[model samples]
Target: MAVETGAGARAGMEAPALEGGAVLGSLLDLKADALGTYLRARQRHGDVVRIHVGPPGLRMDMYCVFSAEGAQQVLASESANYRKDNPFYEEIRESFGNGLLTAQDADYLRQRRLVQPLFTRRRVDGYAGAVAEETAGTLASWARARDAIVDVSDEMMHLALRAVSRILFGADADATTDVVHRCFPVITEYVLRRGYSPLNVPRTWPTPGNRRAAAAAEELYGVCDRIIAERRAGGDPAEDLLTLLAGAQSPDGEGFDTAELRDQVLIFLLAGHETTATSLAFTLHLLGRHPEEQARAREEVVRVLGDRTPEAADLDRLPYLTRVLKEAMRLYPAAPVFGRNAVAAGEIDGYAVPAGATVVLAPWVTHRHPRYWSDPDRFDPGRFTPEAEASRPRYAWFPFGGGPRACIGQHFSMLESVIALAMLLRAYEIEAVDTEVPLSAGMTLRAEGPMRCRIRPVRR
Candidate 1:
């Protein structure tokens, strides 16, 4: 059925469309190269594009909204009409549990209430010590490398995982960090494959993907469950995130049950580390690719702190470094694309959208929209300057998304990125050895190939 258009706007339009090509080809593109496919659609079909996938009887219609205004409507102004009922979210909730990221309605409200205080600006700022300690450890390991050529991506991943792990688990972090690092890829890959599959079989079936995902989920959940049990057994309580959750209660004095606790931990591990890791990795890689920007950022870092590590207070002082990180997020948002199910028919950018249609909001495309960004492909941190940013629509750069359902850990992610970047840049001079990073859009953005950079000790 054709989507009905608004009477006065873009009359008779059902959203511009891209040729779906062969059914098999469309399915393959959606599964394997969703980012590239979305980019092609946006470039060809303006902001509100209609995509038809699958055969006539079983087709799925995806309304791809790329304009900043359209994104605002879908994500913020009219967010209630868009819900986390899409197939992608279903796949995630199945594997990762109905935690904050995937929860809806009553569950979502309760989770948000219980978890909100833990991520507040004051509370998150208190975790800066963990960020600094982990960053210092990373720099020390880099100093040991004989050739000083490092996989910046891998290094940042480990550093971020360790940092957030410490903040979450405290003393038990040492044991959990390696397990999470090993299992997350397996689980996220499973989520990605199943999330995009047009037909998903039962997990009870012994398919290779299902078996791997099951094993990963088992190990991942087992670790969190064990840690939560230990914490709940009335041991010496530390000031970690896990402890906070263990003690957190709603107004009625209700707290998360064992299963709920595990779910929350799983989500924190996924969002807390993965998103920040992507941001840090890309920030460092972008710095490597742009030496002038790197040098300027390094100079600011040095001027701010000659030899001391950065704390939460230093974040505001490091303006140039913050811009660099923001620009990197603009180019490579960790959660590159997310989906919502339209609760009712609505017009987006003067194009009518039907109820129950899948809506895809792509930061990968919107961040590069030509109308909002001048020469969108360039690596220009200046685009994020206060004056320049104030000139654009609020949703023009929503790497962390917008509205009430926005990332709960946005403050924490920024704090981790700014600290990690400042500490690393102060210690090393980076140059891209493998400049072009082939990317894949998984649960988060991933560099499909190695992003290696050669680094030298910065002379005082």
Candidate 2:
């Protein structure tokens, strides 16, 4: 069935047709660089073009609406039509069960509300001291190997994972980091591979990647389960996110059972660390590429903190650092593209999209959309400056997305990035690698290889 266009003013843009098997094959063939291909196709075909990537007779509309109004509608006003429907979460559900990220509608809302206060302004602020101390300790370790060709991406991941573990679990958990690290690649690889493929395979089937992902997930869950069991046995209250959740009661007078608690804990541990780590790694890579930007960021940090550790209060004062991080995220959002399945027929920017259609809204595409931005490809932190920001409309720059389902960890991530960057800049001068490594977006947008940079200690 061809997509019926022109419900309103927008007409003549016909949806692409494909036989089901062929569509699935094409999706399976999509590489890590597939998003670039999608963006190019959208540039030629228009924002609301349709494509068939599932079994024959099953078609979906893919929207690359980069305009502020279009983004606002898809993410905010008309958002009810769109629900989280993607292979990523499907795989996650297969592995982690229905935790916060995998829960839908009422269950999702309930869990979000229960977890919301933990990420509140006051609560996130309390992590500042831990963030600073943890970051400083990581930097001290890194300084020992200043001249080593450090895989900064891996290093940042370690630092972020450790920091989040300390804040959330109140233990270093270094023994588990190796297992966690080993498991992460399996999950990430499976997600990237399956995300483009439209085939639905039963979890009971033993595909190599799927098996690895499941094993990895189980290992990670085992770690979380052990911690939960220990905490339960000891029955001590600690100042950590997990502790808060352990003590929290559901809004409707229900408390999380053991399995539910384990699921939430695993979700937070993985989601909390991976996304922020990727963002910080990319931010550092960008700074290395742009020396002037790094210098400006360092100057701002020094001016704000002046030899003192960064408190949460100092986050507002570090404008340039914020701008730099924002720009990096604009260029490379952690979760570059997200998909939604429209449960009801709706009109998005005059295009008639029917129910059961999968719609994709990509920050990768939107942030680089030529219509809404000036020199969209350029790494200009100024776009986030007060003057430039005032000129742009809301949803024009949404690395954290828009509307109610936006990243709940936005504040927490921002604060963490600021502290990490501030501490790093205070200790070392970072320079880019010899060649410019391009980005590949899987679960997160990361450099294809290790991002090697020269780091020299900065004498006070």
The number of the candidate with the highest lDDT is 1
Candidate 1 contains a number of clashing pairs equal to: 0
Give per-residue lDDT, candidate 2, residue 400: 78
State how far residue 391 of model 2 sits from its true place (Å): 1.9
TM-score of 1: 0.97
Local distance difference test, per candidate? 0.89, 0.76
Question: Where is model 1 more than 4 Å wrong at Cα?
Answer: 1-8
- Over 1-460, each residue of candidate 1 has an lDDT whose tens digit, in order, gives 7775543559436897778766553666776688899999999888888887776667788899998998999888999999999888998888889899999999999999999988889999999988999999998899898788999889988998999899999999988998898898999888877777678889899999888888988998888988999989978469899999999999899999999999888888898888898999999898899999999999999999889879999989999999999999999999899989999998888888999999999999999989899999899999988999999999989998898899999998999899989988988999999989889888889999999999999998
Error at 384, model 1, angstroms: 1.2
Residues 1-460, candidate 2: write the lDDT tens digits. Answer: 7765543446433444322245453344235355676676568766665655545655434544545677788789977778777656677666656788778888888788788877889888999898888898888788688565566788889888888888778863664677777887787677666666556676668987667877888888788888887777766567677778877786567767778888887677668888888889888888888889898899888878889888999989998899999998888888787777778877666666777777777788878888778888789998898988888778878877789888888898999999999989877788878447777767676677768888887776
- TM-score for candidate 2, residues paired by index: 0.91
Candidate 1 weakest ten by summed lDDT? 4-13
